[model samples]
Target chain A: MEIPVKTPSHSYAVTIGKGILREALTAQHDLFTKADKIIVLTDENVWTAQQSYFEANFPYIFEVHVMPAGEKCKSFENYNEVQTYLLKQKCTRKSLIIAFGGGAVGDLAGFVAATYMRGIPFIQMPTTILAHDSAVGGKTAINHELGKNMIGAFYQPEAVIFDITFLHSLSEKEVRSGMAEVIKHALISDAQWVEELLEGDHVTELPEDLLANYLAHGIQVKATIVEQDETEQSVRKYLNLGHTYGHAIEAAAGYGRVAHGEAVMIGLIFSLLLSEKFGKVNHQFTKRFLHFAMENGYPFEAVREFTFEQLTEYLLKDKKADYGQLQFVLLETIGQPFVQKVELEQCREIDRQLRALLAEV
Target chain B: MEIPVKTPSHSYAVTIGKGILREALTAQHDLFTKADKIIVLTDENVWTAQQSYFEANFPYIFEVHVMPAGEKCKSFENYNEVQTYLLKQKCTRKSLIIAFGGGAVGDLAGFVAATYMRGIPFIQMPTTILAHDSAVGGKTAINHELGKNMIGAFYQPEAVIFDITFLHSLSEKEVRSGMAEVIKHALISDAQWVEELLEGDHVTELPEDLLANYLAHGIQVKATIVEQDETEQSVRKYLNLGHTYGHAIEAAAGYGRVAHGEAVMIGLIFSLLLSEKFGKVNHQFTKRFLHFAMENGYPFEAVREFTFEQLTEYLLKDKKADYGQLQFVLLETIGQPFVQKVELEQCREIDRQLRALLAEV
Candidate 1:
């Protein structure tokens, strides 16, 4: 199935299916033909697991650069190395880049494509369920020693071709991480979807068809929000419902340890607790959501590893933090998100409440 | 005097006048008031010369980062260092950047602002005559080891404040290098302007008022082209009239050895020679332009420093080179520019002709 994403700068489609890599790429014949060279940027893990399948199915001749797996791929040093590789390969503005791993690979490759020769065309061929949220959006970046995604651009891809066959190699932890974004998408847009998910089977054990449906739904929710605000100047902030606090935990854990979605799941609960005070959300709903997260094995213990003061440093460094005050997207109701400014003192109070609730649950 | 630059992605004005820094910056009160913090990115040479003037006129408190002088500021190392500086300074998305130098500083700072935290608002305060062209067009970049400006973005500044008083510190070579772009603007847009320049006094010795007038005229020419083709997809290629061969020589001379416009001046002669063969341009006009350049001292000797075979490597690496064919922007007549694809064999012939003509002159 093809979903269209329209933004002010450029518009493209996101095609999702199982075993559709060859067909989706072939459909983009004109885009490929226009490129003088084709480069595939993936990681060691993805390339090792899917190289044979990819080579057999991909129609065009291309060069592949397998980078370090996980957050290491998003480092500034690796970013420079990929650029050097492109330069060595003589890739130009007319060249095309294929981001063929999970979120890390997509983010790094997308940023490289965005800055190479001012800008160039790239397509996201996301290999993990987590990429359903990242690959569809135009937020391309690499991590800084000081922060994650501290440098980047909102450069859109020519197209996003998500081939779920590549997801067969993913570990359960990866699946769990990917599902948190899917859940976040549901919470922000559809209370009915949230209710279904609350009563659904283990997130890691979802049937193939149901999983694809969820991924597409998540992409759609993200696409609609991105269409309204490409640069996160307004409505796009709604999509960051769990990220402000989530990134703090992820950063404190030295990245790749707690996993992005696991940290986000923890952050989702924090936002829920905050929402109970700032919005129409109820305490019973927040506790029920925490129970759902706990049952799904999202590693809430990671939150206990860092003191609120430890997280506070990373929290204030958030890109969304305006003038040293924390900005968060809170749910007025399950399906309605709004931006609110919270002071450190109030955030500390919420932190205390979250810790107490975690002890009770 | 303000010349408005309107591109599809962004629109701003180039406010040009002597000692207008105070008024121009004050007029942008709203932009300043919105920024949580302000940063000034400059080079040692520029800061050393104009820090007092800038500090006196600037109405806001801003942290300044003084980098190495010249093309050193555009190095990959410097780019990374600047990013680290901003992160260390605790700059957020609402922070503003001031690019307060010539082409290199502006290009580096602009690209920094374009990519830092996805992007942030920036203002261009040009400190030299050469920046009259670079600062207005929204072309921001940094040099890669493989090529010049191989990494960058098409990000426009909030406004360009051209305070002509800053030009007082430029050396004779700087003025000559800057005038070449002015001549290029005239060659590609106004026949009368070209005639006036050819008959006028040496470029470095122009009266202050006339120099400012030429800079404004050059900016106007650039602004119009940028408005039509912001991303260099079409008419904007015309602005690269002399850059193909110019970049080759500039790269061969190791970037800073021969200034940008000095190399462009040599490229202009090469393009005119090519135009004589491919367009309505005459051989006499090419030599006449060469004589004017000789009288103004544009360093044609840099062309002889490297063989045609040596320059060929950089030529094929040109961003304008399509599928290995050299793309040249030639004049049908003065004030009329068009794109043409030339083979390596034809380029070698033109190189020979340029050598013979230089020897004769």
Candidate 2:
């Protein structure tokens, strides 16, 4: 299935399906033909697991730079290393970059392409279910010591080629992590989709076709929001439904520990709790969502590990934070998000409530 | 004087004149009022020389980050440091950045603002004459170990405040370097302007009002071309008339060793030599241009310091090189520019001619 994304800066498409890597890549012949060199930037884990399949199906000669896996791949050091590699390879503005891993790899590679010679073309070949959300949007970044994704750009890819075949090698934890974004997508765009997910099989055990449908649906929600507001000036804030608090938790855990989607899952509940006060959202729905998240095993225990004080530092560092007030995307109801400015004291109250709910559950 | 630059991505004005900094910055009250924090990113040299003038004129409280002077300010390490500093200052998307230095500081600061939290508003408060070209174009970058401006983005500034009063602190070499671009603007836009410049006083001894006129004229030439092609995909390539060969010489000599415009002066002559062979340019005109360059004290001796073989690596590394073929913006006539793909052998022939002309002169 092909989903078209149109932003003010550029327009491209996301092709998602089973075993579509070779065909999807082959369709982008024009992009490849113009490139003086094609560079594949991936992580050690992804490269080791899918190297042969990628090489067999890519249908082009390219150089590969394998970085350390997970959030480490999005470090300042690794970002610099990848740039040096491109320079050594004599990559120019006409050279193309292929981001051939999950979110971390895509983020790092996309940013590298965005800034290398003041922007080069890059394609996103995301290999994880989580990337269904990340790959479509132009939000590319590397983490700073002070915050997760503290440095980045809203540079879109020329195309996104997501072949579910690559997901076969992913661990169960990765599936659970990826599904959080899918759930968040459903929450922000379709109440019926959220209901279906709540009534469905274990997120990790979903049928292959069903998972692909969810991924496509998530990309569509993100694409629509991005089209309206590419720079997060307004409507795009809805896409950060769970990320503000989620990033704080993720950053507090030193990144790669809680997993991005897992922390976002935790943040979904936090937003729901805030919604209960700021919007028409009910406590019952928030509790029900929390129950569903716990059933999927989203490491709520990580929240207990860090005190509200520890998370406060990271929370205020959020890109969404305006002045000292935390700006959160809260739901008026399922499928409707609104931005709200919440005080630190109110956030602490919500933090306390989350812990108490966790203890009771 | 106000000149408007409208690129497809953004639109802003360059406010140029003597002592215009105070009034120009104050006029941007809306931009300043909206910013949660205002940061002035400058180099040690600029801040040391003009801090009092800047502070007294600029009617706002802002945090200042003073970096290493000159090209050293564009290093990857310094780029990282500037980002870190912004993060430490807790600068959010609402923050405004002031790039208050020459081309190097503006380049570094603009890239930081471009990528910080995925871009924020920045104003170019350029201090040196060299910045008349760099500040208005929205081309922000930091130097990579492998190449100058190998990593950056084409992010436009909120406004450019070119205060000619700042030029009083510049050295004679700096003035000569800055005038090379003015001459280039004239070469690429108007033949009569070039003739007048050829007949004018020594570049360093030009009257103050005339220098300002030349800088404004240079900016208008740049603004018009940039408005046509913001990212250098088409007509904008003409703006790089002397930069292909100029960058090679500058990079070979090491940045800061030979001032940018001085090397561009050398590149201008090289382009003229190439023009004599490939276009309607006359050999006598090329020689007269070379004589004007030597009389004005451009460092042609630097070209003889590096052999064509020594400069070949940097030449191939030029961002304009497509699949190893050097793409140069050559002049068809005094005011008409076109791109040509020249082979290494032909380039060597022109290098020999340039050396012979310098020796004869």
TM-score leader: 1
lDDT of all predictions: 0.94, 0.92
True contacts kept of 1: 0.83
| Residue pairs with backbone atoms closer than 3 Å in model 1 (clashes) | none
iRMSD for every model: 0.6, 0.7
DockQ of predicted candidate 2: 0.87
Best lDDT goes to which candidate?
1
Tens-place lDDT digits, model 1, residues A125-216 = 99998899999879999988888899999999999999888899989999999999999999999999999999999999999999999999
Q: Scoring each candidate complex against the real one, what DockQ results?
A: 0.88, 0.87
Residues B56-143, candidate 2, lDDT per residue (tens digit)? Answer: 8888889999899988899988988998899889899999999999999999999999999999999998888889999989999998
Give per-residue CA lDDT, model 1, range B37-92, as digits (tens): 99999999899899898888888999999999888899989999999999999999
Q: How high is the lDDT of residue B40 in model 1? A: 97
Q: After superposition, how far is residue A192 of candidate 2 from its true place, in Å?
A: 1.0
Model 1: lDDT equals 0.94
Candidate 2: give the clashing pairs.
none
Looking at model 2, give its docking quality level: high
lDDT of 2 by residue, A1-361 (tens): 9999999999999999999988998899999999999999999999999999999898998999889998889899999999999988888899999999999899999999999999999999999988888888899999888777878999999999999999999898999999999999999999999999999999999999999999999999999999999999999999899998899898888777888899999999999999999999999998888998999899999999999999998888788888868899999999989999999999999999999999999
